[model samples]
Target chain A: EDQVTQSPEALRLQEGESSSLNCSYTVSGLRGLFWYRQDPGKGPEFLFTLYSAGEEKEKERLKATLTKKESFLHITAPKPEDSATYLCAVQAGGSGTYKYIFGTGTRLKVLA
Target chain B: NAGVTQTPKFRILKIGQSMTLQCTQDMNHNYMYWYRQDPGMGLKLIYYSVGAGITDKGEVPNGYNVSRSTTEDFPLRLELAAPSQTSVYFCASRRGGTTDTQYFGPGTRLTVL
Candidate 1:
């Protein structure tokens, strides 16, 4: 069975605070890992995709890194606008399919 | 490119009633998917299609049906609505190949009574 778990279900940070969200998974095989940001009453917005271990991708103040068993989304000097639910998902190998197994997500609130 | 679009942003369905949620993307994406999210829970895959005329069940496909008659549109059908089916539905599409990013629609909020 495949499973994804995210840590720190909720986080509150000061405007300039920096932190990282973790996504650990157990899959038969790993194809890709994705990071997304979702606001209340809206759909998720794609952020980054990391394919292999030791790979990292970044966008603005957000950075995503992946290892064999886990992935991390690091936010540097976050702002109030960066407050949203961060989602982690994985695409496992086999079947050439893109069915994603998603984590429960970490809700982040940045106080200005 | 309008990315992905979903219609009827909100709906209220009575038990046993049926409804179809429409999703369309203009990016010429070859893969499309339907997902449902409940409060405080992660998104669950309902159905997906690799291309036109090809569809398959996902993790939570029990009360749902999907059709991918064209590369641009994928609609999810709820045959018999139930309270458990009340959720926020999202539509996403991805380009061909393995590394393309998946774009998502704004989502539809459904309430079943």
Candidate 2:
């Protein structure tokens, strides 16, 4: 079976605070790992896609890094606008379809 | 491109009623997917299609049916709505072959009574 777990279900940070969200997974085979940001009453927005271990991708103040068993999304000097639900997903080697197994998500709130 | 779009942004249905949530993409992606988001549980895949005329179930497909008749549209059908079925449905699509980015629609908020 495949499973994904995210730590620190809820986080509150000061405007200049820096922290990282964790996504741990156990999959049969890993094809790709994805990071997304979702706001209330809206759909998720794609952020990064890391394919292999030791791979990292960044966008603005957000950075994503992936290892064999887990992935981390690091936010540097976050702002109030960066407050949203951060989602983590993994695509496992499937028969044919690319079904993503998602984590419960980490709710981030940055106070200005 | 408009990315992915879903119709009936919000809906309310009585038990046993049926509804179809429409999703379309202008990106010409070959893959489409349907998922439901619940409070605190994250997102669960309902169904997916690799291309036109091919559809398959995901982890939670018991009360859902999907059809991909064209490369641009994939709609999810709820044959019998129930209170437990109340959720926010999302549709996503992406380019085929090694494409990891799946663009999502705004989502449909469904309330079953």
Which structure among the candidates has the greatest DockQ? 2
Compared with the true structure, what per-residue lDDT tens digits does model 1 show for residues B1-113?
78999998999999999999999999999999999999778999999999999999998999999988899999999999999999999999999686667889999999999
Scored by lDDT, model 2 comes in at 0.93
Clashing pairs for model 1 are none
DockQ of each: 0.80, 0.81
Each model's C-alpha lDDT? 0.93, 0.93
Count backbone overlaps in model 1. 0
lDDT (tens digit, per residue) of candidate 2 on B28-110: 99999999999999999999999999999888999889888899999999998989999999999988775368899999999
> lDDT per residue, candidate 1, A1-112, as tens digits?
8999998899999999999999999987788899999999999998999999999998899999999999999999999999999999998867677678899999999999
Candidate 2, superposed: residue stretches over 4 Å from native:
none
Chain A TM-scores, per candidate, are: 0.97, 0.97
- What DockQ results for candidate 2? 0.81
Error of 1 at A76 (Å): 1.2
